[model samples]
Target: MRRTGPTTVTPVKDTGPPGRGLLYGLGRACARHPWRVIGVWLLVLLAAVAADRAWGGSYADDFDLSGTPSRTGSDLLNAHGAAGSRGVAAQIVVRSDAGPLSAHRDTLTAAGQRLTALPDVISVAAPLDTAGAVTDDGRTGYYTVRFRENPAQFEKSYVGRVDAAVRALRADDVTVEYGGPLGQLARPAAADRASEAIGIGTAVLVLLLGFGSVAAAGFPLLTAVIGLLAGLSVLGLLASRYAFAAASPTLATMMGLGVGLDYSLFLVTRHRKLLHSAEGPVEATARTVATSGRAVLVAALTVTAALAGLFASGVDFIGMLGVAAGTTVLVGALAALTLTPALLGLAGRRIDRWHVRTPVDEPDDSGDIWHRWAATVRRRPWTFLLLGLLGLGVLGAPAAALRLGHVDAGASPVSYTERRAYDLVADGFGPGADGPLTVVVTLDKDHRTTGAQRDALARALRDALTATPGVAAATPPKATEDGALLVSTVTPDTGPQARATTALVHRLEDDVLPGVLSEEGATGYLTGTTAAQQDFRDILADRLPVVVGVVVAAAFVLLLAVFRSPLVALKAAVLNLLSITASFGVVVAVFQWGWGSRLFGIDETVPVESYVPMMMFAIVFGLSMDYEIFLLSRVRETWLETRDNHRSVAVGLAGTARVITCAALIMTSVFLAFLLSTSVVIKMLALGLGVSVVLDATVVRLLLVPAAMYLLDEANWWIPRWLDRLLPRLDPEGSRGRAESTGAAVPAGRVTR
Candidate 1:
């Protein structure tokens, strides 16, 4: 627990030049005082948890669309005291298997009365009180319950009381189910503990196979778990102060675990390699941090940068998701640099203890498959390049048909009460009744019209809306307390996310409302949960291109600066884009095209979740760069020494291939584990990310990169003098220390002919 800087560790024998001095210094400092480093991390985790308890934020589907029609209508309703800012509505669906619901009217009425009496319950309208509440068949009925605030903000006990009151009416012949936001509150928790267990278990198996020692294999998992806990704690604190989506924590955890393990794996692999040549534990740790630790830092920064690029999405909720994920990645990098080395120091030579088999030595190409593959790629680069492009093209084709929208309760599992209620209502009242839009009409304050004129205008507006092509029905207009506002409910003939329904909403706003309200000196706005979700979808679609452009531009600039080669940077950008597109195509095929929906527990095709594409693009783009940098850094190092593209490409591929493959497998396993989640969005993310990693590591990195580099030859290193001067030198491996530590010479015996 000393408070002194790391003293330089001189190798017993000079290898070449000193490498990665900053990272080595930091690692040496942590190694010298392992307990202090571990203790500080523990304190940070505890403090974050405490802060979260005192002032933690809650996750909600709250979206801010200031200029959209939904916002205007919402403002009008709240202005006239007709609706609370956080008002929520729930449906109580009742059906009788043996007889008509009318037979249980008295019981239903009593239950409605009970619901109305519950705390936070604004009112409850029984089936008998509203003409449309009863289905034409007479066996099914529903009641409407409005709440004063969003159910997410309500106390947990409140939902239990409401559940009790609603279930009280259930008889031998009657079935009662809840729907809407209340049903969401009542749904059982879907924990990812099982997913985490699976991911970690798989990682352990992979690590054991790769490292051949129990302690060495376990170290990565231990550091990753601790790092993930710290990241989630910090995310909780951020959520308390800001608006985050319900998916933020899950997404962040996925990223944290994947990167945490990968970063630690890289350093551990390097440490094990250096252990054979270095004089002692101190020098080996220092050299490992100096080289692989620096790569982890650069890779982590690239990921954070890509995530932060989500701000270009222009949606506050989506942007906050970026913040949540980016924060965790940053913490993961810090843990790799500090906590990982400390643990390694503590393990010392015993890291190879508790062996399952003999530990593998540093990667070399002596009769290795990777070396043979590299030689093949070099000999026929054109063939590999064409094959890789053709495969990516086929996989990416489905992306052209991608549709963006929200998934409704109908998509939930049959066991969920919400899904049951959704089915019941759809059978009785038509699919459109499950999602209805509200139209709010407000007269300008300076209007000269009299009260009678206002009434006439309201009637005309209602008739026009009902007559709209896609609108199934429009209720008669009702006036607010101040008489300045008129509200009517409109139901579409199609389901909420259907293209027909979206068309109906737009037509009502753009064609119907403007024409009808012009004569009355009033403006009409469409607002409701359905309307709001549609607006969110539209906004995501519009801003997606901008988000992609920003991310690509930033990553390209970063690569160009670091590699100092325009062709290399451009190749990285193109290959990453191909990987992302292919992954998107897979998502579209499975989720939207219903190709494998049943396998994933999806009942039917749902539009791609609106924010998913943007989220995936930023994440995949950044992550693809990780392997790009890791592999290319070694290539650049070799090319600088040999000045022979063929030799450098072969040597670099042989040295880094095993580590990259192992890292990719570890990440892919972590992402795939989340497929066990019941949440559809989580499933989509898990599949997309997992698939992207597989493609990037195998097809893009192994096949295409070598083929492309071999084809380009000296052109890959060509940089315009002016541009090279403008870009800052970004040697991921320290310039002065690299040669003295790891040395520039390739293993002479292992080099491919």
Candidate 2:
């Protein structure tokens, strides 16, 4: 980018005096008007509850790229009153020692007929019959049913109904097992409910442990609740404008709660520490706002920029997530700056009611492990670099084999009406019965789809797709007045079958299919669960680099502006990167690589959805930076007076370390709490993020950063002379380049409210 201006530094002005004035202001505010703050929040909560009832649901379809296939295909289905179809089928399986289909064909046929009559049933394809139904062993038999409409939507509604109907057919003489997308979707909601409960409880426990005070822990949670409510309320309105989906809100809820809690924790902990020195609560609160508040602002901006980068992928569904997540972070940051300080002013010393008693009157002020870490790194920068590089390389190794798959939100579960319908189809037929790929062929200009082209297209598709690693078969192409389309059967096996096979299908569509038909004057677009999933992956890949670049570049500039010393800014940027990377490394190892997939209830075999990495990056980066800014701002504060780099870093570390550690522990627990979710995706994400935050706080921030910075010494404060003259002064009274606005004593009345 472009060079902006030179950095400027100003002499530090002490704001640490005026002791009782600071403490009494907060006490007076609390002693005078506590209920006003409570009343405002209560009103907001009521409004939120109303909004939730009015506009909370009905936005789930926003994620359905299912309808995004060539609008022509959508229109075709629609014209036939099937336009909005989900393009999936249901499978049901029944086992009986009643001999063979010839023996009990009547009971089987009756079951199939009853299913065909279900409201969502488009049509039931013929029974698998003896020819198709029997497994190699006479012990098992399969039957099939074709759906009237898309199996995806069908599962969302009718699968469970069909499953119950089929089970009613069960007697002491027979046994049944159901499998299919529908069956998966209809699985009990218990897992999801359990996951959510566990996640919340875990987060609370972590917060309690981190703050060592229920009040401190409670503040973050309360702030998070407000932020979540506000985010959802605003998203509800936006949902109508952009067709936002239910998944976005669900994901956003966790993200908003986690980030909101963490951001506030950073500020609250720092402010509390500053107050421990006997600064009036109002002054401490304002200083915290001026310093940590700036960090939160800059951090939120970086996160929003990163999330918005997802828009480059050209997939509306993923794009919606980017927007929703970005919005939540922005709103949370705003709440942190405004509501957090206001509440702190009101709570006053009571805010410390839950604070663990400390033997020392003032906060601890001694160099500990971080000091030793800094000394070692300062003495051995090269070794640290080498180790970091090697670790990143290892963590990234899985990228090569990462598979991309889409599990139908509705189909992946094993409860409800839809899943049962799916099992019925699978038992009666085959696993690929639920959602098969639909390939649409459009004739090239001046070249109609002739019989030769049609025949060749069908043959080429079969040749390329049939018997392909994961494909069950490729059926013949069918022609309508508009075009010719073919359906491919994909039967996923256990483990990562859905993800791996889906990835293979997209490769076929983008590479194999185009080559196969290059001479046929017909181009094809793949539309189905597999293709849509692949498209989403492509979108994430496209957007990730842009998002990372934006976040890094913006953060660098912001840091430089705040610190004045390009060296400090560079250190900030580099340390932040290491922290975030290490966090992601842990997430990938544990969640993606299946190191502990069973414990976390994740499918190690399943390639994580493409968007998950980007989501993790956005969230983790912001949180990591929260600590970075909080701790470093304090360091910069000390450096201004001490003028000794080592002393500055040491004092700063001791001053902020305990609070940062506590905040991180709470954040980690909160994120890990998502491990309780029944949704595998949620579990994976929550566990990954939680583990990463914990790692960042301890390994990267506590140990690595100090060592690296200590080695740099005075070099960490270097700023080019010309740039120094040109850059605007960031902090006129505190650190030379603090980006926060100058603090002025608020009028007594303003401070009172």
Candidate 3:
């Protein structure tokens, strides 16, 4: 051992290996055959897109609630022909602003007849004929068009035909709106390309400013776009056989673009730095890939693993979404590991050929702002740590009150027909009219549930529902042909997304249903989109702990394996969770607490979409690890070299801070651009992701992480001897330093002071 100062001690060096690793070999090979690597990627992209176009299965939302009461009730309804004649209805809402809708009876009748004449139409209820279909004021009426299947399953053009079916009622005096999937089809389409362009545009600016070279900045964008397209193509192919949420591609695009930029940006930054002093492009590319590229690989793995853990939610729709995003992340890593080096090789020493300013890499440490920042944290560890905790605690406080459910159409942009329809229905018949819950009772086979007995049971159930504290109205129950089931709709006083609505659902399930039918030899359940959404919310809430535990444990293990330090791994997990908590609070504040909801085009407060937290946790957890690995890898390298905890922390933070900050800026910009989307769900995901990256990069990374590591000192690197021996020695940045110091894998020209 050697001592550099009174308190600084140096440990014996372990120089077990003197050869380049597989990452270097891959990078060297790709760099040596740049054209071939680029060509192969293009071919893969083309084949994936072509095959997906020809053979890919369409994406349909998988709301497969197998064991829930709502699912059972829904299944019974479908089996017994109670869900209209064939399937769920696509509604048409008609309101006469001029006067009572009685004046529009002739128009409504003609529209119903035309709708009834359309193919796949099982039945069309004329507002005048169906009881309670017209509002009390008679100013608003709706036509329920029951089809053989969900209209959402068909092409939007089909809805256009359905729209034509009601053209006669679209007069100046009549305010007509579509509901359900029909309304979704009727809304003006938002261009996903516009959002993508904005993200790419903003990312380019950050890269340009950081790299000071247009060509260098363009490389990351090129690699990222290629990876994103390839990933989306694969997602399309997966969608052919599996049911993915319709938003899967949108989510994929958002993540793929952001993380694709992330992986490529870091690789390019390291490559440029190495190429500046290295003898040849091949040597620089090899070293860059082995060092920073390893960080990218670990990051992608953490992200993919965290995403895979979404399966713990026990929902395929949610899990498949993870798959969709993970595929892009993995592909982006591939591009960084191979395509990035290839592009670097093609550029050679002229990587900054199209320079706006002389390219700048990491600065010498004497005046490094990051070093000053790290020292500041080290000197006042408690102050910085407490400051970080306070900021995160305040930001994350609202998440404690997080409520999960589906965002109703009432929260959508008014430009959407669904929103208009929701508003009109609420204004005419009360808020509950848009989210009516169907009450279903399955009569026991042992009992004679027929004639007066069945009628009496039905009446009792209906009466029970109508008299419930939250219910505004309840329709008379109608029996199926076999008389073994009875069904009715219950209208609650609150909107579907309201907390009161959630409470009402629970009250119905826990009290009214059992009280009315517990001894009547019947099983009752609330069924409908509203009830089903709430059921799904409960399922997610129950399984959230499973997902969080699995993802955290897996991440902890991965960090342990990579760093060979239990405390470091544990700290990473805890810190990542802190960042996620802050992000969750931001989401709850905006979407649930109604704080700045208008900025996202949301007209009303909506529950955090049931799966948003789950998805955000997986994504943020994975992504936060990227910065963790980037900073820690460099710190570990320094610790290995000098064996001084304080110096290593300062040098490591200084070395990597600029790159990490640039990457975070680009990623945050890419994600935030998606807030331009009118879809509330997309906006929620955007804000959560964008906010998480900012907090993680700034408050957590700059303040909390260094401060804690400084306070812990040598303990930060401690692990049980047995545990250390069991863990793999994976030193991504350390080996590069060793290789440079020994001149084993690089020329003398490649080694910089």
CA-RMSD of model 2: 6.9
Give one digit per residue, the lDDT tens place, for model 3 in 1-753.
321211222342434322477887888898899999999999999999999888776554547899998898888888887747356687889998788878877888888898899878789988888888899888898888887766665666777777787777785478889888778667665568888998899888888887798877998899999999898898888887787886788889988888888888888888887875666998888878877878888888999999999999999889999998998889888887889999998888888879888788876664778888887888999999999999999999999999888887887878888889989989988999889998888888744445787888878888888888889999898888877788898999988888889999999999999998989878888888899898899999999999999999999999987876788898899988988999999999998888988867776777899999999999999999989999999887767666678988898888888888988998898889889888889999999999999999999889988998999887776666567667666665645456455543311111121
| RMSD to truth, every model | 6.1, 6.9, 4.3
| Cα lDDT tens digits for candidate 1, 1-753 | 221222222222234435546777887887778889889988987887788777777666667888888988988898887643346778889998878888887888888899989988887889877878888888888888889876755545777787678675774458888888777776767688888898898899888887798877887888888889888888887876788887888899899999999888888887887777787777778777877777788889899999988989888888888898888888888888888888888888888888888887555644787788899998899999999999999999999999898888888888888889999998988889999899998887743246777778878998898889988888898778778788898988988878788889889989999999987688899998889988999999999999999999998998988777889999999999999999999999999999987888887888899999999999999999999988898887777666668877887788788778888998998899998888889889999999999999999988999999999886787776577668876766553355444544321111222
Count of clashes in candidate 2: 62
Q: TM-score order of candidates, best first?
A: 3, 1, 2
**C-alpha lDDT of residue 750 in model 2:** 8
Taking all chains together, the TM-score of candidate 2 against the true structure is 0.77
Candidate 1 vs 2: which has more TM-score = 1
Candidate 1 runs further than 4 Å off: 1-14, 17-20, 42-57, 83-86, 98-106, 171-174, 444-448, 736-753
Q: Lowest lDDT 10-mer window, candidate 3?
A: 744-753
Q: Report the C-alpha lDDT of model 2 over 1-753, residue by residue, as the tens digit.
A: 222323223333454532233323443343245466556656876787687667654344324444444444444444433322434444555665665444555666677677767775665543345344555434455445455543433334565677665654474344455545444444554334444456557657765655566666677777777877787777766765675644566667666766787678777776677677644777667666655666676667666765665565556766677788776777777666666776777778777576554312224645466555555665776677667656655655555555444444333435444444445545544556455566665555433446676666677777776646656656565554444343333344222235555556656666776887777666666665545556556656766777677667766676676666676677666666665665556555665567876776544345565767766766676667667776777776776655567877777777667667766665666567666665656665676677667766766666666666677765666666666666664441244323223342211000111
Residue 421 displacement in candidate 2 (angstroms): 7.3
Best by TM-score: 3
